[model samples]
Target chain A: MNVFVIGLGLIGGSMALDIKTSNKEANIVGFDANEAHMEEAVSIGFIDRKGTLEDAKEADVVIVSIPVNVSLEVIPKVLDIVKDDTLVFDVGSTKANICTALENHPKRRNFLAAHPIAGTEFSGPKAAIRGLYTGKTNIVCEVEKTAFKLQERGFKIFNDLGMRIRYMDPKAHDKHIAYVSHLSHISSFMLGKTVIEKEKNERDIFDMAGSGFESTVRLAKSSPAMWSPIFEQNKENVIETLEEYIANLQKFKELMQQDDYNAIYKEMADTNRIKEILKGISIKTS
Target chain B: MNVFVIGLGLIGGSMALDIKTSNKEANIVGFDANEAHMEEAVSIGFIDRKGTLEDAKEADVVIVSIPVNVSLEVIPKVLDIVKDDTLVFDVGSTKANICTALENHPKRRNFLAAHPIAGTEFSGPKAAIRGLYTGKTNIVCEVEKTAFKLQERGFKIFNDLGMRIRYMDPKAHDKHIAYVSHLSHISSFMLGKTVIEKEKNERDIFDMAGSGFESTVRLAKSSPAMWSPIFEQNKENVIETLEEYIANLQKFKELMQQDDYNAIYKEMADTNRIKEILKGISIKTS
Candidate 1:
């Protein structure tokens, strides 16, 4: 099986590693616009060989794992070249634009719009690790748009990689993910911005940071090249989440000014239910 | 050595566990406002025995680990009963209010204002774990106000627990903590509130949540009983931090509205420096 992975970074590199391990016969051909990343992925042994975009024509399966902005630019080109029987899937964060872009493509049946809800704060080929998608949720948007055989092939790979699949409409996936995923990255990045600005004068301010601060700001370390395009593609939904988040902070501040600690306590206690909600996500995936 | 832990929650209970392990001759006496917690701490083996407020006079060291609002209420009572040579230190999040309240106490020298920067989102006796303070920072405020002998004794305990100590003025500690610790909690709680509120209508919204959302919102699961008082005491600084945080979010949102992807990318790239900052904190503490 010739499995070609495009854009060799954290997601692409990790997927190649896992697929290589699960399918003994899988030949992992890797490509990235950044030649350094392609070489690093090869040296790291996640890539069996380096391939060009033109070589995607020989792939039995092609994994599109580039930034969403780049996905818009390169995916149509890949679709223009791949054979009819080739199964192609993308793991971008935003889905609506990509799904709509390929809607009228002649080889649309060969492409699958997927978002595997898995990542770390780090990026690049060096950040790749085994079992990156294990016990994680892989959301598939517009599953019906892909050919039946290709869908079956993708599911087999997802199962081999230990991912639980959830199907949803592309628009709904973008809106809901704006709340769950995109808003988290924005909030974390801005929190880091706020604290870093303050740290300018107070050199020891971070000395007092605890695990709480570290956990909340961890996502601020994510790749800007990857996230900026996501925020661009889901502009409306991301802005909406930010508005609601900022309003909540303002209201919390107002409660503090009013000396209504009981209200503040009630609000925190109410949000504590997120523990149960997150626990469900873990159990459902694991 | 008799170490009496009042308010047997995460901090106090974990301290008792580590102190017991590190100092073989030390006796751990636990007390809580709630009788069940006191009994549970005894059963968990972190607390060697149950005691009362009056029993503090027999203690060589007293650890005040209750909420900040409750600290202002109960700390004076503990100070009044402790022996002149006994060291009484607090592990509350807010330091200024408690230090101010005890500014002129007859036994002020016996009270040490300390905030151990160690904890998990979980609370109570059951959440107690060994080595919680190991390699974590412990902020000591107004150390000069503590008697030389008591300060020596407190430092000895901190050493035994393997904690790194940093000294700061109570006011400065509260102000810096507002940016690092308190503000992160508010951002996380608000983020959790925003997402959970949306989840009310979209029952499966959480299914789309990934590790990014989980990490950013983890602090929202903190005990309200523990946090409300910290906010109430650090209200002014917390509100200031919130204003800065909200302003940053609004600015980012405006950039999105203007389709200024380059500016957004710049902001994220700048905040990426926090990775280096946080790395320094981890290395300093560890």
Candidate 2:
């Protein structure tokens, strides 16, 4: 199979590499809106060659991984060009917008809307890592909308990369992701902003910071170009999640202000249940 | 030297183990108000023996590793009981309260107020791991107040553990820690709470969650027995820092609601400076 990957950043570049490992004969080509990333992906050996949108149309499998905003504009065009038997899918964070955009298109059945629940804060071709999808979850949205043969190819491709698939409606996928994934990035970004704005001594942060601070702010280093449009595309759900998050912070703050030690302890103790919920999300180490 | 460790949890227990590694002859005695913790410390070989508070009086070095609120109440009493030559110190998160408690004691010069900027969400004797402090930052507050000879022992102990020491005033240490460490915990705990409350499908969370969510909410599992007291002791600084953090979230949320993608993008791009600041807070891998 020839796998063509669009947007040669962390997701696309990594998937291209893993797909080749799964099937050595599979030729992987890449394209990115950024000229430098296209060159970097090829140089990094993540792809067999740099391909164009036209080249992507002829491929056996097409994986689109651009920012959510750009994905809305580009996925349908890819569908318009791809062969009928070819399977084209997206690895974007949000699903509703992409699903809606291609809902009534002539080649709608040729596209599978997927959100590969994997990635690091770092981005671009250089940030691509091997086995990133191993033991990670992949949510396939609106699977019933896709052709059966294309869906079968997706199942085999994702499984070869060691992923667990869960199916959901596009609207449900977007709503749940707002609370679980996208909001986490925003919270972390705001945390880094809050610390930088409040503390003048970068030296103090470096000196007094520990594992807790590092993990909490790690997501703040994510690519702004990739995330800003995600927030824009999932505007309503992201805003709703932020409102609850901010309200929870304010309530906890008031409890602190009143020196309500019991309440404060209860708040953290209750939230500790996250330990159980988190056990289900596993990262495989080689 | 005979070292007495009061409160044999993750901090004291790990420190005891590392001290033993540093010098095999170091006679480390353990004391915890909780009987099970003391028994576990002895069984795990983190300490040479499980001793009492009274037994702690004659040791050449005393390391206090209790919650900050208890540190305020117990540190002064420890200072009253210990011999003049004893080098007493603490590994609490907040420093101002601990420093103030021992400020008027005759053995004020015997105590070194220290906060080792290291640890995981887990606590207690079983959670103790060797070399937890190696390549970690150790912030010592009011170093000038410690007797010259005892301070020498501190320099050696921290150095043997492979920790880099940074000097700080107690007041400044508490204030700086609020923004860098305490705020991060609160933000994480509340993030976990908000998600659990809003998203009823724990299965969806397990499916869609990524590294971003895992890292952001990891600190939610931290012990309330430890953090509540730290928050209570450093109430003013924490409250002030939370105010700024909340305000920043409000501004970011408004930008999202307004669909001001450029402003949101700029907000994250500006905070990306954390990537550089974080490079300085390196974790030593053995």
Candidate 3:
């Protein structure tokens, strides 16, 4: 099989590596608007060749792993060029915009909207790793809209990469992802900004940062190019989550300001139930 | 040397294990309000035997690692019982209250107020690990209040645990830690609660929780018992930090609600400087 991965950055480069690792015969070609990323991807052997949109015409699969904004802009172009039977899919963080963008495309049947719920804080071709998707969940939205053969091909690729699959409506997928993923990025970035602004001494952050701060702030290190678009595309849902998050923080602040130890204790205890909820999600700490 | 560790849960238990790991001949004993924890500490080899406050009176070093509120209540009592030469120290998250509680004690000179900036989400004896303090910072507050000989002993133990030391006033330590650590716990807990409330389907959280959510919400898994009192003691500082944090989130939310894409992009782009701040903290993501 020939796989053409556009945007040879972290997710795209990682997918290229994993596909080749799973199938030795798989020929992977990569494309990136960033010349430096393309060079790094090729030098790191993430792709067998550097390819173009013209290459999509011959690909058995075309994976769009660019930023959410770029993915929305590029999906129609990919659908226009790829073979009718080619399994074209996007691994964008937010799905609704891309799904809506391609809803009326003539070759919409060739496209599958997928989001493999996996990533690290790092980005770019250098951040690519082979087994990132293994043991992770892959959410596919509006699967029925895609042709059966393309859906089958997409599932096979996800399965080959050791991911569990689930289906959801595109709108629902974006809403939930805003809470589970997008909000996290915002919280982390804001936290990092808050601490940096308050503590002008960078050495203090370095000396005092424990694993708690590291884990909580990890997504603060994600690429601005990738994340700024995700926050922009999923603006409504992100706004809702942020409002609730801010309200929650404000309530806790009020309790603290009033020296309401009982209320503060109860608030923390109530939220501490996340231990059980997160355990259900396989986020085992011990 | 004889070492008596009060409150043998995660932090104290890990301290015992680390001391033993570094010096096999150091006889370590433990005391805890929970009998099960005392037994678990002994069985896990975190301590040679379970002892009492009376044991602290005779030990060369007395370490109190109870909840912040409990530490404030117990430090003066423990100081009254300990040998005059014993190096008494408490490892509570908040320091100001404990320092104030023991300020007028006859044996106050022996009491060292220290907060080790290290921990995991897990709690209890089973969560104890041998090298938890390695490469972490141990902040010693109000060092001048401790006798020179006792401070020397405290320094030796932290150095043996492979921890760097920093000195600060108790007031400053409480305020700084409220921003860096206490506020993080509250943010994580609230984020978890907001997501749980929004996503009524527990399965969706399980299915969609990627590394981003896992990292951002990890501290929500911390023990409520351990954290509740820290918030209670550091209430003012926590309230102040939370106010600023909520204000920032609210501003971002309003921007998103107004569909100000450029404003949203700029907000994220500005906050993305957290990458540089975190890098300064030596948090290597890739």
Q: Identify the candidate with maximal DockQ.
A: 1
Model 3: CA > 4 A from native: A201-206, A283-286, B201-203, B280-286
Candidate 1's displacement at residue A181, Å, is 0.3
lDDT of 2: 0.88
Q: Please report, in order, the local distance difference test score of every candidate based on alpha carbons.
A: 0.92, 0.88, 0.84
Ranking by TM-score: 1, 2, 3
Q: Candidate 3, residues B68-177: lDDT per residue as tens digits?
A: 88887778888888887999888888888888888888998998999998889989999998788887779999899889999999999999988888898889888888
Error of 2 at B59 (Å): 0.6
True lDDT of residue B235, candidate 1: 87
lDDT per residue (tens digit) for residues A57-155 in model 2: 679999999998998888888888889899999998888888888889999898999988889989999999989989887899989999999999999
Clashing pairs in 2: none
For model 1, residues A25-127, the per-residue Cα lDDT tens digits are: 9999989999999889989999998889998899989999999999998999999999999999999999999999999999999999999999899999999
Using TM-score, give the best candidate's number. Answer: 1
Per-model RMSD to reference: 1.0, 1.6, 2.3
Which of candidates 2 and 3 is the stronger one according to DockQ?
2
Output the better candidate (1/2) by TM-score: 1
Candidate 1 CAPRI classification by DockQ: high
**Which candidate number maximizes lDDT?**
1
Worst 10 residues of 1 chain B by lDDT: B277-286
Chain A of candidate 1 scores what in TM-score? 0.98
Task: Name the weakest run of 10 consecutive residues (lDDT summed) in model 1 chain A.
Answer: A277-286
